[model samples]
Target: MALTGAGMSTASGIPDYRGPTGSQRKGSPMRYEEFLHDPEGRRRYWARSYVGWWQIATARPNAAHAAVADLQRSGAVGAVVTQNVDGLHQAAGSGRVLELHGTLARVVCLDCGAVVPRVQMDRRLRSANPGFAEAAESVADELRVNPDGDVDLPEDLVASFVVVPCPVCEVGTLKPDVVYFGEPVPKDRVERAYDLLELAPALLVLGSSLTVMSGYRFVRAAVRRGQPVAVVTDGATRADGDPVLKVAAPVQELLPQLVSDLASQPDDDSAEPAEALAASR
Candidate 1:
């Protein structure tokens, strides 16, 4: 199984949290509590997220994504569990993908439990607030899209932005159908990931720092089971010292080459270690 993170989508224009080229923006990340309890916080979130929508929506899958798909097609990699909510793996034609964090493709009504497409939400917000996005365009240079697909807009710009109610429940809060930092992943989803890990021969972690327990727990599980755990990322990671093999290179450049070498190996049935595969690069 392949476990991926924000670094997996960095090449596709998404920012990672701890990578060298990671996001460097203002304010704290959105929390589940803040979104659930604070009215002003939700207003701020939807406003910034509205402007940042184009960043993730227009992003195309990059080489790293294609390489993962290639590995899956060749029967090397089986299931993919990604921490990203960007939906790039699907865009890359990868199958059996489980999004650890829920996707931004849709939004949910916190009160009525009605889910709707993000595009539909966007269109509604645009219609409700005339000229708000264009007004923020004057400070376009200041725009920085965060890891969760929200931008760091100035407070002044956010203050006047009108937030719409959920269509299904006129008063229910509309939140992106994703797990925020302070939120827990659904129990069934976590168990499914563990089942996939148990089924796989080795655990290949791509582009994650493993800073958070959401992805790090799998690494610990793999070690307990004596499964090979390989980390391929550009910069330092929380498990930099614990992984069985650590390849410090950009995955976009490394994975494609690694896939080619594995495909061409004479002993195709033999499982080549990630260290050996990376060494060929």
Candidate 2:
């Protein structure tokens, strides 16, 4: 099953990327081209992402992540395709997670392509800006991981912020490996996820809008393959009318109950759980 976007981690206190209460400004986050071309933009991006890492590091998976992992453990789920960079699913004990967007907890040097643990940069950030670590930890819960490892901070407080350079290449800047808007998911990653989807009998979507083409493409692929597509989310999604089963509820609240209900069904298999739920209503 594929769980797209930040909503999967919303219950864990991380905000969504773009929703009524999303973390973006003007309904958008920083773009890749802007980060590359604008020095000030890059500075701000890195600054905020650095602070946001505190939250990312501390966030634990919520019930939804656990329930999905339970499905994986039972072999009812083959894989979890996710767009989030937070790596919470693995923390939640999920075994077969396909992180479509790269992890936020690591850094990649643009010049040499040497990967470094995010902890190294965090220590550097603390050492470079003495009291900034305290300030970052204080506001960590609200911070969102930006294009680079920088996070968003209040504008008034940004004046005290400083962007740290890559330790490997003093000249080159470091950027998080996450897939930004307009950046295509690496061809190999997409292909691997597609291959996994082929193994599952049904596609279960949770807490995603599927607003981006990267995610919507999967929903389309499932439909074309004649697989049952079920969605559990709060608001309207690209899959709204197309899904075989639509559960308009918060995933953290619905998933465990749904799993329990399915577990209690008759062993004769006279009725499908989805059909029974549909009839009960």
Candidate 3:
């Protein structure tokens, strides 16, 4: 069973992109082409994204991630397919993770497709936006508000922030490895996730609303093939009614208990541990 999106990472203090109280009041990030064509839009995105990148990088894996890893280790989960670019799942020790979105831990040049570690971009942002750096530190307290992951800040602060261009090619466009709003999921990555789905009869949706078609497509694929689906997240989902089980709760609290209960179950070679875990949760 694969877990996807922000809900799974909420425990790590990362904000959900969209939900009842998301920053944009809608789910999902900006589109790739928009960033390319709109210079100021790019500036605004990079501003929030640059400071937000620190939180993304420094975030530790929470219980949900650890529990997922434990389930994988115990042979309860065959594989994990994630829509998140955050590397928390891998950091938590889950193997065979199919990253549906490219990782935020890396950068890719759109023109050449050459990838560089995310640290390079971080360094560049720091150098280019020293004023933003000072303002970011001053607003650190304001940034951490909305304990439930909803953050509100001044628009001017966001607008004044600068976005640095690619270091390799001054004219070359750079983007995070993550899939954007309108971009299609890479064909090979989708195929690989489908291959993993074959090993298990259930798809476990975690911490995501599944609003984006790139992710909803996988859930749709699983349902079409008669695989039972179970979801755990904080609010409404694209698959809300269809899943065999739906738990609208914070994943951090639920996942640990689910992992423990599933791990304690009797070893039955013929039994479906994924189903058992899903039912238990």
Number of the top-ranking candidate, with TM-score as the measure: 1
TM-score of 1: 0.94
Candidate 1 per-residue C-alpha lDDT over 1-281 given as tens digits, one digit per residue, 9 for 90 to 100? 99998888988888876755334434578999998899899999999999998889989999999999999998889999999999999999999999999999999998899999999999999998889888888878777788888888788889998999889879888999999989999999999999999999999999987888999999999988999999888877778778468887888988988888777777746547474566755
lDDT of 2 by residue, 171-231 (tens): 6777777787667799999998889888878787878878778877888998999988877
Better of 2 and 3 by TM-score: 2
Runs off by more than 4 Å, candidate 2: 20-27, 134-160, 266-281
Candidate 2: residue pairs that collide:
46-150, 48-150, 48-151, 48-152, 49-149, 49-150, 49-151, 50-149, 50-150, 50-151
| Alpha carbon lDDT at 17, candidate 3 | 64
Q: List candidate 3 stretches off by more than 4 Å.
A: 20-28, 139-141, 144-162, 268-271, 278-281
TM-scores of the candidates are 0.94, 0.86, 0.85
Q: Provide the overall lDDT of each model, using Cα atoms, as 2-decimal numbers.
A: 0.88, 0.73, 0.74
Give stretches of model 1 more than 4 Å off.
21-27, 267-276
lDDT comparing candidate 3 with the true structure: 0.74
lDDT of 3 by residue, 1-281 (tens): 77578788767877666764323453335677887788776676667677667767788999999988997887767788888777899999999888888788888888777788889988888887777756866876755522121234456887776666667776567788777777788899988887888777788888888887777877888888998888788778878767457778777888787876766666674446555555655
Best-first order by lDDT? 1, 3, 2
How well does model 1 score by local distance difference test?
Answer: 0.88
